[model samples]
Target chain A: MGITSRTENQGRTIFINVTERFDFNQHAVFRKLLNDAKDGCEFVVDLTAAEYMDSSALGLLLLLRKKAGNNRVELRYVKPSAIEKVVSASNFSRLFDCKAVSPL
Target chain B: MSDQCNTDGSLNLVFKPVSRRLALVVDDEPINCVIMQSILEKMGFETAIAHDGYEAIEAFELLAPDFVFMDVIMPHMDGREAARCIKSMTSGRFTPIVFLTALDDPEEVHACIEAGGDDYLSKPVDPRLLRTRIYSLERIRSLYQKLSRQHDELLFKIAEEQENEALANRVFLHAVSAHNEPISGLDSYSRPASCFSGDLVLSCRLGQGGIRVMLGDFTGHGLAAAIGALPTSELFHAMTRQGRSIPELLTELNHKLCRILPDDRFMAAVLIDIDPVKGEFCYWSGGMPPFVYKSKDQLIYHSSSGLPLGILENYDFVSEVGSGRLTDIERILLMSDGLLDVRNQEGATFSSCGFKDLMDSWASNDGFFSALDERLDQHCQNRLPDDDVTLVSIDLEKALAVLNVSSDQSADLSPEPEGWEWALASGGGYLLDHSEVITALTDTKYLQDWPAEQAERLQTLFGELYNNAIEHGLFGLDSSLKSTPDGFHLYYEKRQALFDDPPPGQIRIQMTFLPRQQGGCLRLVVQDPGKGYDLTRLSELEQHDDPSRFWGRGMQLVRSLADNLIIHPPGNRVEAELRW
Candidate 1:
């Protein structure tokens, strides 16, 4: 009922869609999805369906950055449908370039 | 002792006076002497007859007769002369000498009277008159004996009481003499009404950094009031030297006093802890007069906050702490109620309000205590005080450096505990009571040797870490959720709900401390039975941890304080190590 993801271009680019709550409970599922992403691939973490996201969800995003690896991987972000204070406070817009268009 | 007297002040006659009531009769006239003997013998008196005045004096000394009848007109030495000599020989006794007068002449009777005769009995004595006179005089003699006996007993009782008071004074002097070990910045004075004082002034250097000064006044006065100080002083000295917190000291002292003292007795006290360097001051006052911190010329008053010790069963005592620049403080004054209640020759008291005037006039000077002493003495002079009084002043100088002297505070420091753990059910609502947690930690043998400050820091650390594991792991209350206005409330409500009926999970903690040659280190591992967090994220936050960055506040706190912090894979279990 929360998050779903799909791969494209032989997993070179990944779109991770999150729905409902993206709190700590989704950490394991999110981890598996990010670990399988190819190194230096483009990954777009979509939180458009997420109604709520806690600090652990932020932790997951940081992990996603590592699994994606290297600057060439290009960690992109899709803003949640209901903008969370956690996102604004995390400076994720600037840190992961979530607010601008994906460079890749 | 009979007080009944006949007309003309003579008493009624009695039957055979005891052998100890022997009467001596002296007369040169043989018939007169025989008549006197017959009368005295009939009245049950043993009679000693002397023919002349010289013989009368001789018999008076030898027999020490209770009654004497002297013949007024006698040869050799006259009756009057012998009576005078005999009276002096009797020392301080009521041995009465009655004159036997045959001649009906006023001059002769008068002469007999001047020579120490108590009354006159005419020669050829009237039987009734003689009987009345002897009975009345005998009544006076016995009453005098009884009064002398009582005087002797009274003297003895006084000596015994004085000796007991002196003993109580000796013990009291020794007990309160603990104050004699002068505190560097503190000047104090105490005086008792009687030989014993009921006040205790205690000040000591806390091993860490601070001076704890206490002035306690026991209820009432003298021995009963001073008795409580013996135990109070022992505990105060021991605890203050070890540098225990004021709350612990108060709670333990209050508990012991309540246990040992009768319901009617209690101690009114003021306890102050001053960290001169840090400019921190904490105080707990009960029943004593309000305290005033004199800074510059201003007087800031703080009223007492609790009942006197030993009165409450389970006192919820709290100490008030304040911080200000130490250089601003002039002096700190503490006093027992006795100090204020002391009165002058005119019966006017110095009053608690007088301290303000004292501060205004002289607190900044070196002669502050002397000025105060002069004021108290001027008020009371030599007039006895009604209570025991104590006053202490602490001048704000260079941060009470006297306490910086490093004493071997933990001479018998308990070795670090080997290993122990407690597993409380999630349903235990108040299992994590901070005091209980602190007690549990301090109860360890190794923790006992740890300095109080260090022990306190660890208690705070454990509290934070354990709480995080239970809340974030077991309860799964999201930290980021708190960003919302209602999130904190909602999180607490959910937490309380879990306390009543918690999910199937357990929080287990194991601790292992190792003694290093340098010092020691403690390793604490806490685990919760819940889906663990991703460790890669924990390291991510740790790498670029910004304190202002909100979410992982708890983890940030735990990681920063601990020397080595490791969150195992499946992040439900975390280990932290602290080195000392």
Candidate 2:
């Protein structure tokens, strides 16, 4: 599923909740979700429940970083699946956010 | 009892009928029955005689007589009882039975039907109608047998096809089972399609220098995909053992596949070479995912695949396989598209952002594979994967180093004109004493090879070339430039001033070497970039009239010095032969 919402309580804290599964069929839906959520909100995506993610999923997150004005989303991945790990390894993590904790 | 034969009393034991038919005559009074039998036999049926109904029943059971005329008034057993027994024997099947009645009573005819009779006639029965009915019943029986046989064969064929399909599925499962395991690579974990995986991962050492690693994903799964694996595996194993370069192996694979693979089939692949000693890695990508390398500080580099092979004929991948040197403790990760394109239960990707954070946090504490497994497991929540997945990783520090010494040295030297090999033989421990020889040597035709403005660039080049000839070629010196410092500078300065002017110098040069079609040679020849010492002296030097003259010494040193050398037609010019 895809992560959708983010809100900043203060300059120090941010929260991001899941929105939808970022898959081939839902690519368009996921894109709209990201666009709507990225209106100057600082958040970290909580992925404790998402079971699978693909390259396109990674692409959308990259788009989120760009949309967050100065790429300051400060998004952190809480948990990632086996497939997510592979997508994460592809320089995306190096580009913006860092993996936080693997809840599994 | 009467034995009669027609009207002529010739033993008269048999009755003959005018028509070609047979009739059975059964009677206690043989004489009366015989006459009746003859009368019936005259009509059309063949006839036989029986004294009692018991004998008649026996004949009917054995011969299956189509038409029977029985006497209701028979000895021992009655005709009505015999008819009932015969009817019971042929129940539910067609057999026309006719009964003979002495009395024309409707009640008697009804009693005969109850005895399983089709029709009854008076004592004087009309035989024509009986013959017609028997013929019609036989025709229907033959038609029923033909239709039932055809239906049984069709059912058998459909069952056989179902069994074969099941057998094929079993074989496919076995092939994929071999690769199924708990993986522990950069991104540890595996996902296959519908339990029948088509993507393949292979690792083997290539020759003595490099380790060959590859991941291949076919277009479709099951039988459509299985066809490509046999060739893919065979070529990969063979080429890796032969130490063929990735390009060569890829080209070979493409050729073989194009010849046999169906039009719809194709394969996307990524090939890698990791050298532990050189700390270098080479990658030849066809159409896989973007392979990445993570630095100790978390900096990332991406190497994406080119177009897949076997998609087009004679398509060449010309660029050098991309390569990089690894830093200490760095990690290199490779993956296929399946992992990147996965969607979760809500139809959304795990996303690259979430993936990045997960990796960066765990990158330091755990191995890449374990961390990958833990992170993905957390994100997916133990859901099944929808696509095929593969991941590969190599430790940066463990990867070997590749040094381009030939290119480095060539950059320092200069190129000579076509078709020349100039060998310089320098002497003395100090280069100062050899100034005149250096100046005279530089004045030869060789200095004229390059452009005038590039003279300074030629200084270090000529210095190396001259020193190499004098120390290595002449004195058999084994000192390498990398190892020697003292001789290097002296050699540099001597070479600097030599190319300052354009002059004529009869420097004799020669060459002797083997040349190849695809081979080339580069030479750094040094000579005075100036006019010759004198035309007469040059002519005399060319003539070599005085072998002992020091003025012609440069000529002699160069002439016998190399494989082939020529002072240009202009007295001041010198040229070296480079087979390349």
Candidate 3:
């Protein structure tokens, strides 16, 4: 539905929380958050509340990687759900650190 | 008071007439009509006068005045009624109406507005107020005219763009499907979310009595995603016609797409090659949904195990191909992910379980695709899918039957009375650089109108014979080096080294076509100058039973396809005869 972000550890790390659907509709906010982040800062994208994701959302994540550099971005709380197949099918695990965790 | 300045020393209003404008004045009293006419004439308007509401309508229709002034009290028809009639007749043109009222009653003014009065003059009719009101109304009217014109232009442009898009879609569809061979037992359905579909389905009859099919889904739908289909189909049909293997075709396709598409865009594809004669199935799946194979008692799934095409350069696609025997499998089904992602009115998807359930419910494979399509329609309630959807069903039994009939018919061509002969000789250095010489040599003008199957068989026969003469005779390389799978690559590496610095030798190929009573005969002779092998070695290769061995299969294949074969002196020369 929307995107929210907060900085912690003196701005060295940023946690981006995506709520509800993660799709092309969230492109603007996601791009702004990525643009505003400081250089060399690590990013942790939280997908715990996302119920669905589409191909364009995957494209956005690729764009984020292109801007943040390799290994500087990590995806946390990717539930072992239907959307996981889409992510794994594209071999996204080879490009990013994807941690699949159980839903609370 | 002075005309240029009032008592307060403010500048007086100067009226400048851009063009001559007409004004209509209506009143029951003569004094009132004269007063209005004097004010309008001073403002540079040519005036027309009407005595009552009846005359006012008549004068309006005749003059088509730019502006009108109507008294509140009149005979025959009241000014309010006349104002309504005049406004209706204007027909989208802006004509400002000013009502002249003697009484200062707000009720009368409200009634005047209800009858389409633009503005009103109170009592004696102030000239200054009328001048300012007229100026503002003219500005508003011009603005409305500009907006209406723009609205019409926008509508026209949209229609033109749609027409162009439809024409382009027709051309694109033709390019994608024109080369498709209508082979039986192959059924497919594709629907796009927009004017253009990114899903591509291509099937071509293989030159060697089989069929090759590829179903690919690009990154997204519509025109941007469909652009890659043009080159993909062209390459596919050309390569399939040349009798290339599945792995080789996939590798070349991957290289072509990677060079053209963007970084994030790629195609998820499944390629299947069926050889009914050998009862073999070879498939390669990359980043697509699992394909299903339904047998007599069991259903098998083959999931993708490699990245999609165009994602990485230098992809080793040969290792990704999986091969199996067509033992009990009756039919195979392939689909894009869009089929599983289709959502119903309740926002629930038709997942893999639904697909499997439908397959189980079917009693036989005869109506499986129709049943699947019906189920999909029932689940989604005729809703257009969010992405492009493609489904392909291939019946193995039907395909085998068709293959058998076609192979038998290839030999049924009527006898021809024409005869021709051709010969070519090339040095080792020239042959190494132009390894495709066999294709050129087989594709002569004399064979242009022959059946494709016959022409392709001749090409295969020529390829094997030429390779044997050059590699075994001229280069003196041992066929035993290709006994193991890894040794196959090593053998090629040594052959490539020899090609770099080839020995001094020449290969001469001569072909003669002779007329016959039933069909024609092609006699091909290939000669080379090198140390010939033992005559006993040829007999051992003819009876080699291990079909898996890659080294001696070339001579065995030649023997099977040729009607007559003979090795000339020293085994450095071979002749093959084929009847069609």
Candidate 4:
């Protein structure tokens, strides 16, 4: 599994999705997605399908926050419990708005 | 060739001659050799003739010809055999061989090719087909030469780059680990995913009879991640040598990294300082996994509550230090997150629960590190880890022994300089912000030859005296405010507020070193401008039996560390004499 992204709301918002493993392998693709997004657009990272994440992934999120501005970036549906532990451990909540939807 | 006319000129044609190429003709029949030689000479190549296989090899070696025409049938040796011999003599250089065959059989043509004949012609070879074959083979030979030359250049470049990387790695390793002290109780293992490790572990002997260890993991693995470690290690060793506390060291490290590193990069680290004399352990963790302290009966984990270094600026950075009694801990284990993130073949991680289970299964502290190493290897099935892995374990009793022996080493008894005096006056703002002044005061060129322990003690003595004058005399902050935990926080807060816009006052410091019969003595004097307090209160507080009270401990420490102590009238001046 890998990273994918799409635009919505007439290109006003971009939704980037990460699946399975999220680590350094995704660095170039992630930065390219951030770079391609329209300026001043809201960014939402969907990690619902992610099973593992590393510190490099944390660094990528920090980079995204820096580009998207603090209020415009949000982490949606951080799930599988394990990834959420990393999110909290790294104190990402202080830097971005994170929303986790419980799996049924 | 082209003809051109100049201004006064007649028509002129120019010809540039090409270098002649040599060809060899091998055949037992004189008629076949003559026919091949005539055609090759018509194509502007000079020719050499050989009778058979043996003669062909000799002629090929002697002439170093550009190409060869071989006849299939011969007297002593066949044309195919001669072609094979000539091919062997050419080695890596390409020399085309065309066989002259009368037989129309496909098997004979295949045999000619098997003998290294590049192509073949009929008994009466046609000049036009011979020219086409020569032109195409010459094109292939030139291409091969170009490719071989480029291959050699690429190999040379790669070798040069590898040598440079090896040299840089050597210098980097020395800078990172040369200052590390070999303490008895400290054991560590580091395995980088690549040639250079992003993880760094440093251990330094604190000046005040203890040890300080730091384990830091940068953003990624390999050379890019390893770059930040140079500054971190340099700062850690330099500040620890000055006997600075963990918070002060962390503050400076954070500020330095923040100014240098990019926004996406930061270091996750855990630092532990163990004071053997006080029987205490203090640590600061930032964005790293929890460090575990294991006793015989219980285990304690200190988790990180601060952001990783280089992420927050100096004004927003807060170092949260946790402390506990050394008696309660049998061993302290610290690791990078990479250890827990190790994955098996099935993609299952060696999570924290696995670590806990392993710790629980250990019956005793003996060989714990070895056991953990074996377990990790078994879990990963000998595959190289995806991230750099580091683990450190410190045994309390052995660490204390190392510290005791180090402090007990007798100072060098060499004669000292006759005498020297240094003095400085600084405003309250400068004193509050720069603690390096304490180090500078004690680290004069004259004292450079003193034993490390003596120099460290003088630094501590000066530091305590300097903090007293600024915190109590200049700022007028009450020591009673530091008795309770909340008040301790408040006291620092008030101190920081006062430091933002320091009050108008100055403190004077003077130090004098004098050589004595046995060793030497240092006289330190610090004067402030505040009104004096009751001198009797100091002795009363010293007699009090409350060990946990934070107030009055600085004065007690000063008194114990100095051989003679005096407070001048008005309580604004303090004098201490330390003898070696």
The best candidate by DockQ is 4
Candidate 3, residue B539: Cα displacement in angstroms equals: 36
Quote the positional error of residue B10 for candidate 2 in Å.
72
For residues B22-119, what per-residue lDDT tens digits would candidate 1 score against the true structure? 88988888888788877667666778999888999888878888888888878899889998998789866889899988887999888888989999
Cα error of candidate 4 at position B372, Å: 4.4
Error of 3 at A50 (Å): 2.5
Clashes of each: 5, 97, 1, 1
Give one digit per residue, the lDDT tens place, for model 3 in B1-580. 1131122232123333543388898998999878887877777788899988889999999999988888978889999999999989987677888898988889999999999998887878787777777766667666867877887888898776566556547756798888898866788977665666677899998764578889998876555565688888999999999988988898899999888987657788999998754557899988788988887778888888777787667888888899889878778888888888888888888884376677674426647667777888888787888877788888665554332111212222323336665555545344433345555544446677667777778888888988888888778898888988888999999888887776767676666776566567888888887777677986787676887777888888898889899988888889999997
Candidate 3 colliding pairs: A1-A21
lDDT of model number 1: 0.68
Off by more than 4 A, model 1: A1-104, B1-20, B24-34, B47-150, B175-180, B220-222, B299-305, B319-327, B344-346, B350-381, B405-580
Interface RMSD of 2: 9.7
Query: Tens digit of lDDT per residue, candidate 4, span B1-580?
Result: 1111222132111111143378888888788778887767765677899988778888888888888888788778887887877777777678888888898689999999999999888767777667667667776777877887888898998776666556546655798878788876688977666566678899998875578999998886555665788889999999999988888889998998887877788898899998755567888888888888886687777887767888767534334788888776678888888788888888777874367766664426657767777888888888988888888888665665331212221123222446665555556344433355654543446577777888778878888888888888889999989988999999999998886776867676666777787678988888887886567897799899688787888888898889999999988899999898
Relative to the true structure, candidate 1 reaches a TM of 0.49
Deviation (Å) of B99 in candidate 3: 8.7
Candidate closer to the true structure by lDDT (higher is better), 2 or 4: 4
Candidate 3: segments with Cα more than 4 A from true spot: A4-16, A26-43, B1-168, B352-357, B360-363, B366-382, B404-580
Tell me the docking grade of candidate 3.
Answer: acceptable
